[model samples]
Target: MEINPAVTFKHDRSIMYAKRPKVLIVGAGLAGLTLGMLLHKADIPFEIYERAQEVKPLGSAMYFNSTTANFFKQCGIYEEFLAIGKYVSSIQVFNEVRGHEFSMDFEGQEAEFGANGYIVARPVMYDLLLRQIPRERIHLGKKVLTMDQGGNGVLLRFSDASEAEGDILVGADGAYSAVRQGLYAKLKKAKRLPSSDDLPLPFSTVCLVGQTRPLTAEEFSDIGLEQCQFRRTIGMEKMYGWATFTTAQNTVAYNVIQFLTDETSKQNDAFRNSEWGPEAAMAMCEQVKDFPIVSGDDKELTLGDLFEWSDKNHISKVMLEEKVFKTWYDCRTVLIGDACHKFSPSGGVGATNAMHDAIVLANRINGLPFHPIAEEIENAFREYKAERVEWVQKAFDSSKAFKTMTGQSFASKATRFVSKHMPAWLFQRIQAQTCANRPQVAFLPLHNDTGRIKPAPQPSLSVRAPVEAETPVAATTATATTTTTEVV
Candidate 1:
């Protein structure tokens, strides 16, 4: 019943693990696949297991920028994207109910800074990544149940009873990662970590996400909705209908409905004791009747409640939790994509951030040893977090600003009279930190290339010598002199 720790490091073939250090990727989604492809290009041996029996092609759009596009190019998967991606020149930011909107032109790649962003379908993107690697290396229907540390390595136990061991274990898995759960249990027991459980969530907010028919070519031309657009239906408060192109087949669409801040409205009653679905969506909508979003004009919006708030402990439930819903992480395990950081799809960055994590980590891992990865891998994670801190904060601040700028409440309407002309410096400062303005950086680890160089030997993440001395030089010195005096 007790599984021992595996301290496996990336290494050369040995008697112990002839096929050791074989990375067992838990999830087969974008992040997992990106990690796999980058490792394969570096000639690192790895295997990815997907819970699903096949590569899933559902889900709607993920906004990808030039950096992500360039990443695809770096991984030798760009042309394929161009083949499937819907390219456009700009994204129109508009009010949902009203026709008023502004457009940001996507300048040329060379003169312009940051990534040329695009909307990607989950399946198309996955299929493209799959093409770059050998099919034999990827396993389907392999569900990872739990894992534990082994001697110099980690053992992965699957539900079907299959197992795998690896030098370094990565939870490239998403936010709700099992690997994250395992690492958190170990780290929390030791208790030198910070409280990540403090992530404040939607104050009595619920999200409704569902797919409807995609846009017709005529609709695209009429709205001038080339890349992406925002439409706000203005009456009193303001709830905008956000629309984006998912796939060319015109089948994938994500319609969102969310409510916030104001909790005492009659609409809250509907969701308070509801089953959490269409009923919830309509109830949330009832509160926003003052500012109605065009449900269906160009096309009808199909909506369904995607996730709900429940406070019950995993299975032991004294009661269903309703405070806020979010997850945290640890050193051995990490939260990637939506699992680590979540956002209000009200302003669609959830999926984009997820893809960005995949690419950022891939760039860092490319051509380098992930095991003895520079302490910067931690920093890369930090930088990734840093990169997101402002971006997400800005997003949150921006979301609040969106409400405040337009005067949501009596207090906001009063505050709205104050600053119509914001300073230019603050705007420039924010623009500077963006991944679009800057390519998110990841570290490249070092390893030997025997076949490519001399026929030396296939290199690996083999464990290195013992931990270098952390003690100060003064402590190690047997004898020391304050001053050099030859006199005696």
Candidate 2:
């Protein structure tokens, strides 16, 4: 991959104006790193602070939609991303009990939207973003203790008794954000805080995620890794699981999620503090060990099969949370990504949304003049939030809806009926239309026209019926095969 000279970091202090308002970004996650990269490319002065000692594989896999792919191409890292990630050509969903199945094809999405949805391990994506940023600009292990805003800028105090000042503060510190807490305290004191910002929304599902060791040819062939197809199995007793293979590593990553719908507050509290480790993950797997993922006449993949093939230490358990705050900014301090809106993993949009937030926020700040006034910065923040709030809410609702549809309930059954019976042409049409309407980075030019901005060609909503529905299977031992083709 050819690296862009303009996108590389340059440590030329002489080019920076002394009077310019420096940006103080909290958190070194996807949102913060992306914002930092944009600031670097635009020749703006900024610094990022992270509480962690270094970047680690904290999460499992993430899916980047067409919109995010465009942003990466603009950042001049799309080729690198392609080498690390796998493009998803189709998604298959099955009702484990009923044996009803549905598959959505994404054959023409790359040409229509300029890119298809790509999936990569979270740690790999984090490292890729980190590589584009200068190490000096990122400070690790500096946990923020408090924040104070003065007439000209904001002051930050760290846990190590260190202090820093900046003209603008950005809180991309994720859901449990200290900056958000500080901003909320100030807002409440001024009687400007909304009631929704007082507490986090409760999450009821527990997820165990892990990646298996490299698979042999037979093992890989049985799992059917064609353009990295995503398979989701909706089983009995509110158990759901998803599986996909990583191209670069030749490993299969899977998530086993169980929904705790009727648990009391006491049980929830106990579960929250429960020790999560390999034992817990294996215990969860034992409960659904026999749950069928892909069943054929001679081949069957189950939860226990994948668990047995995984590295014990790599397995992790986490409770999924969902929320979208009513407030995103308070004066000079603004929140992004999970800090403002968090999504359940059902839709695989959390990281994508975070990346989008970075692009939009960077565009707004990039338009500001050097040494922008407080009022000017505030207006830019407002515009950023106003442009993003509706889309984030829509994505949040969609994720929740997907979670409901993939569960063992009346709604889930109804959704299965629709999914099983929906025509392939119709599904493709809807997907194409959705992809066509996806948002783009307003400031970045199209991939082909890197030197100038060109309006994206409006894709036609024409649908093709290339994907065929397989016959429903009644016997557990019967084989159900779906044809696979490379779309990328």
Candidate 3:
């Protein structure tokens, strides 16, 4: 495979040689795993610490837009991923009470952007990423207790009374990040912490997500073919909405979001800090048990029906928090993904943003000289933050706006009116403009020798060729070589 020269950085193979810094990453989620993959490609030593005993199917499902699809292609996992997901041709919006409907076609996106949006179960995606990296590098059940950084390096203390040191540390630990909290605490004691990092944006919406067993042909037909389409149904009020998507795995994933409009601090606290478990999730489902899941062809499937079809153990409920923090790094410590900027999941771009962070940050670090000093590492962190902040803020705002426009508010009504009345071509044009501005992985090779990292050979698995791959290659041999290299 030829590498694209445009994305490669030129550097002497051997100059000022020093031992490459080891990175200690907290959280083995998407962001952490991606960073590890990039570092592995660059021959940088790193380790990942995950609090969970093992990686499991925890979340409902995630969507990958063109931007994310391109990144996966670069990583050599696009074909495998494409085989697991269902390509979303269009998105349909309906109002149960108002009897309004609209559709946005995404089929043209494939021609313009190389791929359309695809949806897959969260676990399937996680497994694909996990398979690319060596299992020894990941440490499970390792909860990060605290971290301290000094002139030499960063020291991490784990809950199991173990300690480790690394040249740099990254906190990819999700919204309630312990690394972010630890860094903030240290800065606050020194009286240098910013006010914005003191608290996260308040959340008033609660969500329940679950996946149903594979639907039989008869069951699927009863709900209409629209059930197989990406669909969102708005409620009569501004505070409620639900979305459903059926994947290639034959499972149906659904999300129910209800916004609290009471405007009371108690109500906010109750929902935000609410304990979520199987019982709680089922209880919430009972509240709207009769709510329509999909209504068409004189047939209606309710939330209760979906819940009844899902395993109780797979259901989860939680609050949706949205915010972009003012600070992302301090000294040898930095943050990525939901640890810094969290989205409302309305636009389905949060995971994509996380993957983007991994690429940008890795590229910045890869640009540094071999065995860089602390100053050089800090400079890389600064550059990474500078490149990402604006884009992240934009995505954050867009997601919030999307959530609002799908509700029962005046804005939602206006949005619905335009969507229902607009021509399909106009919608496609608007979507094209949005995709044009979407952020892509930069400073990385895409086509030639410098573009991607090939992984070590693994056992054979069945996977189809990516839509973009003209000549199909065996899955086992196709992803066997590392495509990118770090200057040493």
Candidate 4:
């Protein structure tokens, strides 16, 4: 009936929930589940909390980075994931103005850096990661309400009238992260992104996802679905991006998901419930339902249902433009994955970066001494946040730029120039390299551009993905002087 505060305790492995310095992972989504798996691999005791009554199939599919493949391989699920996802040779970007012309292309093995890139269904990905952990470790239907830190450690409270204590608490509950909000409230006395009144760009958009009737290899080839493909809007006016979800060589998924950015400005936080609306989110699924993408037999369609994701319908009603997001943690409590950072789905780093957070944190947990583990909570969190925030910020910046460019701003002729001149290869390579590598200054979130460097001694974290210094920093210029690979 009444809620309590968070406290710290000496976690004892003998008892499951009593483990001191125990990890409380909120939001059982990709980040939470992956973090649990990594901790499990390192023999660390952790508890994952999810507010969902059950894992719901909200979005259609997710895109995985090549680096993520390494984590998956480490988890011994690389092959299994390969089975569920669409593995493509490359990711191609095209300029729609040039008759949907090709612009950039990134190809090759992720092993050079870490993992391979793939597109997979959100639910399936969630289920796969969830399977890696024991049923007891993940507590569903538990919503985090708040967290408190004393001299010793931290205590966590849930809306379900439940309380737990640990040395470190991770807010993995996603964009509307309670732990993050609670921690930031206590630590900074200020709100974080998404949770605040920061309204996402009012530009309207539709997310259409569905299961198709499966496609033949010939049909797929005809549509140029051989490898992963992308098509940008003309003059970057309409954000149209789609990829194939091929798990096996011949097995094309009947389910294809497409994201299209528009400027129709539908009402904020409203899910268009019509089976078919002018801006139905699942229209892409409907559009391709009869496509040749098939599983095995032509009789069965890979699709089970069509769905849409609206800001209002999201588990967390936060948007990319939201300034005060889910939550923030300093010291005893911390937030990771979507719980801490929510970017435009277009960023494509949401799942990958979240998994990265879990993996990197898990690695540190495995490497730390048990005694220091409890006290060194900040150290581990620092490492995770440092690396994750920078990368996530990059992802966010990219998504926002792309959204702005393609959202059809009549006043914006800059989008036209960018589409006509900027080399698509540059973006693809930049993303691939960034996702696959980490920078030495991984801990700091602020950019050291134009004399913004910090003299802090950087540690070796295998994160030198090249984009930190190599690519253009959130700026597009005229003349296109950079000698980037001109793919189109």
Clashes of each: 41, 0, 11, 45
- Candidate 2 stretches with Cα past 4 Å from truth are 1-19, 97-100, 222-226, 264-266, 270-290, 295-297, 437-445, 448-488
Evaluated with lDDT, which candidate comes out highest?
3
- Relative to the true structure, candidate 2 reaches a TM of 0.82
Model 4: lowest-lDDT 10 consecutive positions: 479-488
Model 4, range 75-104, lDDT digits (tens) per residue? 567688877776555433433323334343
The models' CA-based lDDT, in order, is 0.45, 0.70, 0.72, 0.50
**TM-score on alpha carbons, each prediction:** 0.63, 0.82, 0.83, 0.65
Give candidate 1 regions above 4 Å deviation: 1-20, 53-56, 88-96, 101-110, 198-204, 210-241, 244-252, 260-332, 363-432, 435-488
Ranking by TM-score: 3, 2, 4, 1
RMSD of 1: 10.9
User: Which tens-of-lDDT digit does each residue in 326-416 have in candidate 2?
Assistant: 9898667889998889888887878878877887677667655455545556766776776677668878887887787778889978976
Tens-digit lDDT track of model 3 for 1-488: 22121333433324434556789999999999988987887667899999889775766778886766666777788889888887787777877653548776677666665567888888778888888889999999999887888656788889999988888899998888889989999888988888877865667677888888888646654233532467788898546898888877777788888877776335546555423767778787888777776633444677787888888888888778888988898767899998999899887888888987887777666554444445556666776776677668878887887788678878878877876788877876666544553333344445322212221121111111122222212321223211111110
Worst-scoring 10-residue span by lDDT in model 3: 455-464
Task: Tell me how far candidate 3 lies from the true structure as C-alpha RMSD in angstroms.
Answer: 10.4
Checking candidate 2 for backbone clashes, the offending pairs are none
RMSD of each candidate?
Answer: 10.9, 14.5, 10.4, 11.9
